[model samples]
Every structure is written in structure tokens, then in C-alpha cells.
Target: MLKIIIAEAELEPMPRSLRSLPVMKKKYGRKDVVLLDSNYHHTSMQTLPDAYRRGRPDIVHVCLLNALESPLNKDGGLEVYVHTRNDKVIYIDPSWKVPKSYNRFVGLMEQLFSTRRITAGDTELLRMVNKTLPDLITEVSSGMPVKVMHYEGAPYEPDPDEVLVIGGFPHGDFVSDLPFSRFSIHGEELVAWAVLNHVVYGAHGT
Candidate 1:
């Protein structure tokens, strides 16, 4: 499996953030993958009844939409995560069915934000995850040695048991103290989606 961390993704519930879902879902939403939404800014989880009354961390909506449409999430299922800026982490059940139509999608998101969960009949989708990404790495590796995606260092050599970490922000360098290898797949910086597509394709070979 290819484990990817979309670190520092802005989850502001603005129009831009909401629109980002379709774009991200079109790209990184794939089978055999786990995309972690790390350090996203979102509405306070404790404020349940008024969740959407504020604004949700749209990255959760985007990532869940991506995973619901992923082809590789068929059998074993994909374990995806959302790490909020406030340090709260939740794992989304991959089998959660996302509404397909845009109107329904919006409504569904509202319900999820307000209730803090996803339910299709008896199934629950939003699960609070406890594992932390130390230095954004170290543990949760479980044989998948993590790699930092950069624009420098050696070329990216994809491995089945490796975790790929990429910045989801518009522009910024990673904070110091990344303990894994860093390599660039391009000479210059690419937009988040471009980089996302390139890296996943390189790793999954399709």
C-alpha cells in the first residue's frame, strides 16, 4: 500500500477550500492508497451541534470524497486520517459512501460537520484516531519507511512499502527535523495537485 501524508493542508471552509475537493478527488483518490490529512485547520470538534454553523475543516470533506471514489479501496479498504491543527486526529472508514451529486454532497457535508460522523444505515465513518505522527514520522511506519517529497536530493524511487509525505499548502518548506529521505521529482516547485499526481503515479505505476 502507498501511504501518503498531505501535511499542512488548509482546511478552511471557504469557497476555495470547498472547490479543492473536486480537484483533489479527481487526482489522488485512488486504490491502494492512504492519504493522511495532517495538521488541517478546522472547526472545533467539540462544537458538534454548531459544527457547520461555523465551518468545517474542508480537507476532511476533500479526503473522504477522494477515498470514496478510489478504485483501490475495494477489498482491504483504505485507512485514511485527518489530523487537525489543534492536534485532534480522526480516521475515516474507507467504505463510507459519499453522495455523488454536488447538491447532495453539500448536504452530506453539512450533516457530517454537525453530527461529527457519517452513517449509511448502521455503518459509522468518522472515527477518532489516536496514533500520532511523531516528527510527522517515526511511528505508524510499520515497514513503510517514510519519504519526504522535495525539489532537491536524489530522484524519487517508488517502493511498495514506503510512505510519501507532501506539503498540501500553497507554498512553504517543511519545518526542520524531518527524519526521512527527501527527494524532488521536479526541478522547480509544482502546485499541490501537480505534485500529488506525479508522486502517486510514480509510486503506484498507473
Candidate 2:
């Protein structure tokens, strides 16, 4: 299996501080929780710390869409996880179909944030756990070598069952320093979804 971890993803529920903003309230009336989106709340986010890198759930959205639809995933050779900036880990079922519409995807994520899990009848399609990125890595990787995708790192080579970590933010570096070795397939900086697609294709030797 090729296990991919979208680490330090900028995905989270709206903070209490932002909830009071008239723009936020106007956009999301009476909703106690909603996905923090920079595209929709850019002005409100400027006051927050590390504002440039936060409120980018769209990064995670595109990454998930690519990973879940890739050839590796269809062949049951891929496993995907999302580790949010807030230290929350999202577990994705291989069979779950991600919504193609960005708005719908955001809504699903908001629901997941509020309820902590999305269920299809009895089988859970998505679930969130309160765990740090390192802890989650330790659990999923077992004894497999863990590698992170980085442009400055060594050239990447695909290894079966290896845990691959990709940054899920738009432009900045990861907030948490990961100890794993870093590898890169591309020479220049690419978006999270582009890198994810590269990894997926490389895994299948395509």
C-alpha cells in the first residue's frame, strides 16, 4: 500500500474570534461551525496569526480529490489521511467519493468538523481524531519508512507500503518540523494537489 499523509493541512472550523465578525455571521448565520476558507473570509483572517498560511481548506480539498480518484486508489494500493494544522487527523475511507463541487466539499468538511464523523448508513466514510501529526504517523506507518515530499530534499523513489507525507498548505512551510526524510520529484514548487498527483502516478510507475 502507498499511504499518503496530507500533513499540516490548513483545514479547520471557524475560530470563535472570527465567528463574531459581521461578514462571517452574514455568510454563515446561526451556524456554530463552518469551514474556515480564505477565499470567503480573507479580510477576517488577516488579524489571525500566520494568516497567509491559514484558512486554506481549498488546498486540502483539491489534494483529497486527486488522491481519491487516482489510479493507485482505484486499484486499492493507496491509503489517504489528512493531518490538519490544528493537530486533528482525518481518516478517509478508500471508497468514499469526494464531492467535485468546491462548495459542497466545504459543506461536507464543515459537517465533519461539527460531528467528527461522516457515515454512510453504518460504515463511516470520514472520521476525525484528536491526535498530533507525529502520533498519527507513528500509528499508521507501523515499521514502514516514513518520507515527506519536499523540493529541497533528495530525489523521490517509490517504495511499497511506505508512508509519504505531503504539505497541505498553499505557500508556506509546515508549522511542525517533521523528522522524516524528505524527497522531491519536481524541480520547482507545485501546488499540493499537483504534487499529490505526481506521487500517485509515480507509485504506479506511470
Candidate 3:
């Protein structure tokens, strides 16, 4: 299986600091956990550190949608995980159909963060665990080669059963030190979802 880890994703609930903001309180109300979205909370995020790279749940949403809908996943050849900036890892079931609506997607994420799991009857479709990126890699890699996607790295080629790490934030370098081979499909920077699509379809040969 081609396991993928979207490391340092910007997906998270509204931080405690931002919870009291007028915009947040007005939009999300008194919910204990609300998904932090740059589109909806841009002004509030500016005061936070590394603001440019934060508050982008849309990136994660797009990446998940692209990965889960790909032919490779349907064929049982792909596995995906989302590792957030807060050191939370989201385990995804390949059969889970991500909500197409961005608003609904955000709601689902808020619920997941609040409840820690989403189940479809008896099967768990999504679950959040407290895990660092490196730990997640070690658990899922299982001796397969680990590759990090970067524009300045070595030329890329599809390798079966390898674990790939792609940045899930909108901008800036990874916050964690990823000790893995970096590979590139393009010389210029591409958005996370775009790179994911290219890699998934390229691997799927479709």
C-alpha cells in the first residue's frame, strides 16, 4: 500500500486565545471546539505566531477529498493520514466519503475534534489520536522507504509500498524536523492538494 502522511496540517479547533474574538464568538458561538479557518477568521489569526502558515483547514479538506476519491484508494492501494500542527493525527478509513461542501467539511472536522471519533454504524470512519509525525511514520511505514515531498528535492518516481509525507499547511517550511528522503515532481512549489492529485493519479496510471 502507498501510505501517505499529510504532516503538520493546519487543521485544528479554535485556539483558546482566539476563542474570545468577536468574529469567532459570533460565528461559532460557545462551542467548546470550533474548526479554525483562515477564510472565516483571518483577522483573528494575524495576531498568532506563524500566522501566515496557520488557520488553513481548507488545505486539509482538499487534500482529503482528492486522496479519498482517487482510483488508487478505491483499489485498496492507498492509505492516508492527516497529522496536524498540534501533534494530533487523524486516521482515515479509505471508504469514508469526504463531504463535498466545504462548510459541511468544517462542521465534520469540528465534530471529530470534539468527539475524537466518527463512526459509521459499527465501523469507525475517522478518529483522532495524539501522535507526532515521526511516531505516526514509524507505526505506518513498516520498513518501507519514507519520502517527503518538496520542490527542491531529488527527482520523483512512483515506488510501491512506500510511505510519502506531504505538507498540509498553506505556506512556509515544516515545523517539525522530518528525517526522510525528500523528492520532487516539480521544480516550482505546488499547492498540497495539487501535488497530491499529481502523485495519486501518477501512481494510479489513470
Candidate 4:
């Protein structure tokens, strides 16, 4: 079985903090990413590698989409956990229907921000896990070695009793206490979704 963890994912609904950015004269920014609200504002970093910091939400979303759609997921060969920026762990339901539209997807994810716990089953994939990143990784390790997808390490190789931790953040490397065997599939940085595809496909073959 192959389980995938997206750690410290930047995925989120439009944050009110984004209201502080300078408004541009376009609906979508120069990067072709959506502007959050009526202000049409974009942060300075928005023009950088990650536009509006929007890639994370989309990255997390597409990762699940591909994972669930994979043959591995159907045969119980795959499981997914997404740990978000606000310190929430969403154990995604493999059976959940992913929203095809941006607005609907926003509605689904916005629930995670509330102080109240959401009650849902196959529909709401966001299962509120109160565990922090280190604890969550420890629990998932389950007396097995944890494999981290790091650009600095060697190419990835699947192992029995191993869980792979991939970076979910658009920028920055993972800095944590959990023990992991770092490995790399490629020298350059691949987008989160691309990395997910490679890992899932590679693991499925072994």
C-alpha cells in the first residue's frame, strides 16, 4: 500500500489578509491566476513563482484528483492526507466527488477555517485532525520508516512499510523533526502536481 502525505500545504480559500495587496487593473493577474476579490489586488509574491500563492490550493486539489482517479486508489493501494497552513489535517475521502468549478471548491474548503467542527462523510473530505505536523507524521509512520521527497536526496524508490511525505508548499523546503529518508527523483524542482503524478505512478508500478 502507498500512502501519500502533503505536508504544510498552502491550500486555502481567499484570505482576508490578501485584501491588503495592491489592486491591479486586470481580472486575472499577469500570471493567469485568478484575483481573489473585488479589489483585484495582488501581493508582490503573486508575480513570483507562485501567483497569488494560489498554486498550493490548486496543487493540493489536483493531487487528490489524480490520486483518487488512479487505479491504485481503486484497489485500496492508495491513501491521502493533506496538512494545511492553518494547522489542519484533512484525511481526504477517496470516494469524495471533487468540485469541478472554482466557486464550489472554495465553498468546500472554507468550512475548514471555522471554529466549529464540520460533520460530513463521503462529501466533505476535510476531516479535522487536531494533530500537529510532527505528531501526525509520527502516527502515520506506524513503526515504519518515513520517506521524504527532497530535491537534495537520491531518486525515489518504493519500500514496504514506508509512507512518502511530499512538500505541499509552493515555496520553501520542509523543516521538521520527523525522521525521514530523503530522496529525489529529479534534480530540478517539479510542481507539486507533477511530483504527485510521478510518485503515485512510480509507486503503483512497484
Give each model's clash number. Answer: 1, 0, 0, 1
Q: What lDDT does each candidate get?
A: 0.52, 0.88, 0.89, 0.67
lDDT (tens digit, per residue) of candidate 2 on 89-109: 999999999999999998899
In terms of lDDT, the best-performing candidate is 3
Clashing pairs in 2: none
Candidates 2 and 3: which is better by lDDT?
A: 3
What value does the lDDT take at residue 54 in candidate 1? Answer: 28
Measured against the true structure, the TM-scores of the candidates, in listed sequence, are: 0.59, 0.96, 0.96, 0.76
- Model 2, position 173, has a per-residue lDDT of 84
Off by over 4 Å in 3: none
Tens-digit lDDT track of model 4 for 24-89: 323334432232322233444354434534435666777777888887787777878888765678
Tens digit per residue, CA lDDT, model 3, 84-155:
988999999899999999999988998999899999998899999999998999999988999999998999
Task: Estimate the lDDT of model 2.
Answer: 0.88
User: Which residue window of length 10 is worst by lDDT in model 3?
Assistant: 197-206
The lowest-lDDT stretch of 10 consecutive residues in candidate 4 is 32-41
Error of 4 at 126 (Å): 2.9
Instruction: Report the candidate with higher TM-score, 1 versus 4.
Output: 4
